[model samples]
Target: MKIAVVGAGLGGLSFGACAARDGHEVILIDKNDEPGGVMALAREGGFSFEQGPLILTDLREDEAVGGFLASLGIHLETVRDDRGLSTPDFDLIPPEEYEGPDWRKRRLEELFPAEKKGIREYYRFYDALMEIRFLSGEKKGLLNQLRLLRAFLTVKPYENMTCRRFTEKLFSDEKLRLVFNGILADFCADADEVQCFTLPFVNTETAFDKRIPTEKKGKLYYPSYRYIVGGCQKLPEALCAYILEHNGRFLSRTVAEKVLVEAGRAVGVRLEDGREIRADMVVGCGSARDFFTELVGEEYLDGNYRRILRDFRPMEAVFMLHLGVDFDPSAFQKQSLCYYYGSYDLHGAVEKLRSGVYHRGSDGYLIYFPDRHAPAFAPPGCHCVTIYTVCPDRLREGDWESRKELFADELIRLAEEHLPGLSEHIVAKKIVTAEDYRRLTHMKKSSFGGAVPIWKQRNPPYLTPVKDLIFVGAQSESGGGVPIVLLGAVEAYEKAIRANRAEGKGPAAGPV
Candidate 1:
């Protein structure tokens, strides 16, 4: 069981390919010579682009990541979300076709037609508070947790509310409360501080296909949003080629640098050239307070988790730009993922992006167009596009290495008001500031998306008190994606193959 797994990211190549397909003897460390931490990649002239998480949704109805990449035989190519809807008072709002849930309640009654009875009483109070909080805390089994203890006291009135005061108390519509606060703006918190049971997974296909089940194990499906025709660096090189076809061990530019504790457990890793392997556990995949206060030395933590990794608070980060353009944003019908408001004052531009400063007259932008759903990420007629906008990871109005190209030229002058000669269709460019995501994802405030202190304050948040390290990043939980961090690295390799069958240690792989 020689695990290791430091940070090849996409939750350390999905927990080093499910703990080396569970015979365990994996490796996968990374400071990045290659690996999808932030599911990254960014070439230049011949195109490529997607420097992180660009809507690759094929989890195929929770089999999770196309049935975990067809159980690692691996199959990449996917593409959906056919464009339209460019906004700032429309450019093309005539797109609707992925019909499910009465075509998403007739596209939210055709985009808030005076809140059609407050959009059917807001999806019947968000499907009865997600069926009493998943029939009392996520459908229990194994003797139904004592018959679901009265559906966990009817989930205490939808976990005491806040999806910005329950969607602004069910509607008065400021463009549907800034389109539901831009679907929780990469969730760096706010929507009255998240937690209305995390706003019914904020439109994951209208929160599990417009629920109508109190039984049948709290049914939920959600899968339509695809694009992985090339970038997403072929998903961590297909989980590092299924952990090197199961023999595992693929270090790459090493640099783990610590975590080799002894009597107090987690026995491996210590590689900034000094090299040491050891291991029965030590997994991390990066930034759970940067390897517990810089690679395992918070003196084995436990002053209430070293004051929760020293008063954690990082949630705001994006500022990408990418571009490789000539033109082809689905030829202007646009929308290979679009959300541009320009100003509705999304919570006062998230309180002026915590003073890292980017007031594009009140910040907003999340355009993508990976050549509009993958024309192999651009070449013939060009287009990579990308673009992003959340902020504040620092740059107190100056040094993001000399003003990240003037904040990518003021977000390309607000993405040239919906690409009208978008700075004469450049041939190539790249930006990614917020101190280049805290120097390419060590993520202090480079946040990107995940960790708003487990919003509603820790439903499940433990980022290393050192039980053999552990934390699969995006600051470990709160719905970071790439199929929720590859379903949290296959549930931490099914709790490390159930603690190696309780130390007898062998034959246990259940959970393909």
Candidate 2:
């Protein structure tokens, strides 16, 4: 079987690797000259930075990712987070400050110490929501039914409520509410608009009881979190190399302009240059919107899928300021990620953000100093820092093109307040905005890719309306993030392989 995968992002590469190893001839295509998609590495002077996700966690508890890297003879160092906070800036709080109960509980207590019982009950409720255990029918009990009924009546799970609503109900402290809202920025969604169910699930996946320490602090590890020493891009590069070693081919700088469909089945793809490559199975590791509406043509799509794609709102975009400074954050002697609450009212902060207004008084900022863990990321006596914030995708009155410089300047000024004299220590600095992201990655709205991962929309979410064409990646059911994207690729390949075998073809080759 000949399989063609569009977009050589992590998802695309994973699909290619899986199919190639399964005994099929696979061809991976991408418009970028290299793989890794948004996960690409950026180097300027002696400083190296990860353009997209800075931290990688193996949430699935599977050894597939790490084992795959080891097969390629690559050894990755595991890093752990010594202290956790709701925000990115770690310099503000002391290590002992996080010592009481879990941060979530502490945050609740801080917010509603007067309503301590209510706050504790809220945590208990959140815990119950996260504790999902699949039991056989024989194990059913009346207690479980009562619990389910209570949840359905009080939780209002069907209302699509936001984190703000939950926080308001659970606590009244202004600072605590802001702390909760600060984390909401991480999801790139306004707290009031983001579904409440999204919060607990993300909390479980990222900040549960799982905490491991490495040789360095502020780095996190799971059973499978691994890094490709040269940088994260090396993983995808290695996967591409493996495919080639197994007689599979990778075509860089080739964009899949359209899906080639014959008799309602995906035959292959037509490249941007009008060259058509035929394949037994075609998998799209790109946006579902682009795949169906632009590439596949809306005529082939059913109304439901089209409506879903049209109505789905993408996650908010971010503006990142990557700086190479002459100091190591690890040596600074701070122990946790910091969350600075510049505003007293969390709802006001969210409203300001949604309205596309920058709060000039917002001293509250998120900052990450990677040199605290990965020293190899920077030169001697220097550190790499990424300052990020969720900004409006479009400037007020659509003047972003003319106002970008002003925005960058304001961000730098904001950083100067936290890292006194930070402007002088900068050896290299680069700013990436939503527009720049779109131009570079070609993702819609330049979004970080994919919708928020909530229970309602898990990985491999809706089945595409088309019979043979499948969608994967952040834009599909995988719900973004590196690990989920990789898993989505594997799932798509498994389905494609099964379909091929059902058509009387043999299994594709496995990884070499």
Candidate 3:
């Protein structure tokens, strides 16, 4: 079977690699000059910076992402890593001494003496969820099922609570509540909009400190964060190389204008240059609304899919400044990446973001040192820093291109509160706004991440109503994150291959 995949992001690359490896003719189409979309590195004046987050999860050899890559004979060096969190009045920095895994709980109790009882109770709930997570990852069997059920029963009382209600129930101090819910601002979601069960996973203690043990009693307890030695681009590069080696083709710098369908089945893709490539299967990713309405035509969509496209909410964009400095920022900021939150009102911040109000990094912003991991990203005597915060794709007052520089200056000024003399040492800089992301991701309103983790929200599914046309990516049902997209794409490909076999369609020119 010949397959044409649109948008050579991680989703398309992973799917193409799988189909090509299975002896199918695979062709990947992307508008970018390179394969990886946001994973692609940005270079300015000898300084390199990744457009996405540096720390990832589940890429170890025994993990889901790593196991899949090993199957394709592709492996890259990975380093264990973690991030730091801070607020205006407090910081969650790991101590130099190796504290126990439950150190955060003890520290929180110390900081908020009045809420010590609530803190202890919250950790109990967190432990129950962690046990459920571990059991769910076990091999499927009657024993595992019963074990998972027993674990789930511990926290069953809070199953229906929203993040806001649960946090209010736990901590009386608003600052203490922000410790768990502040991360949701990155998704442009309100605490009331998300499920309480996601709080522990999103605020995983292991992610805040690398010293925390991920293995307990010879079994994986909590997931450890990791980073690709070179950068995240390595993952996409490896997948693309595998596809090419397997006799597949990548049409870079080419736009896939439309998905051609006849008699309710996708037949091929129409390129922007007025060329059409026929294929047995068509896979797509990007803005679900844009792709369905403009490329595939909404008339062909079923009522259920159309309803999801209308109701599902994708996240807003981000404002970032990548700089090359003459000093080592690590001298002041210990962690390579630190989230500096200026405000504790996460709900107000998220509302402002949705209403076209830019916080200018006052709510929260992160400063990352890419050079610490990828030393070659800067000159021998220099280092690199990326200061960024989430913002709306469109502003109510003015456009991004017109106000991006001013906003960048304001964000840098805010970051200066943490890194003294930050502006004086900058030798080079690159500012990225929502406008740049919109053009790069090919969406009118760029969603920096995928859909917000709203409870009971229905994202677009991989298997569409139209036969032979599938969807995969951050925006797909798999949701956002590096491990999720990589694993989800492979699963989608397997389903597609199975469907083809059921339809009596095998490889185009080889034995299946």
lDDT of 2: 0.63
Name the weakest run of 10 consecutive residues (lDDT summed) in model 1.
206-215
Q: Write the per-residue lDDT of candidate 3 for residues 1-512, one digit (tens) a residue.
A: 78999988898898888888878888999999988888888889989999975788988888889888998898888988888889989999888787988888888999999998889878888888998888877789998788778768867888999999999998999999999999999888899999999999989999988988899789988988988888888899999999999989999999999999999999999999999999889999988898899889999999999999999999999998999999888999988889999899998999999999999988999999987878889998999999999999999998999998898899889888878999999999999999998878888889877888889999998888888999888888423888887878888888777776787774444333
User: What is the Å distance of residue 129 in model 3 from its true position?
Assistant: 1.3
Residue 326, candidate 1: alpha-carbon lDDT: 76
Clashing pairs in 1: 59-65, 85-92, 164-191
lDDT of 2 by residue, 47-158 (tens): 7777776556552222555655565454555554432343332222423433532655664466456968756756665545543221112245987676565655555543
The lDDT values for all models are 0.66, 0.63, 0.88
The regions of model 3 sitting more than 4 angstroms off are 140-147, 506-512
* lDDT at position 363, candidate 2: 32
Q: Residue 45, candidate 3: how far off, in angstroms?
A: 0.7
Off by over 4 Å in 2: 59-75, 82-112, 133-162, 192-197, 204-230, 329-341, 344-364, 398-401, 453-463, 501-512
Candidate that beats the other on lDDT, 1 or 3, i.e. the better one: 3
TM values, all candidates: 0.33, 0.81, 0.97
Scored against the true structure, residue 149 in model 3 reaches a CA lDDT of 80
What's the C-alpha lDDT at position 414 in model 3? 86
Considering TM-score, which of the candidate structures 1 and 2 is the better prediction for this target? Answer: 2
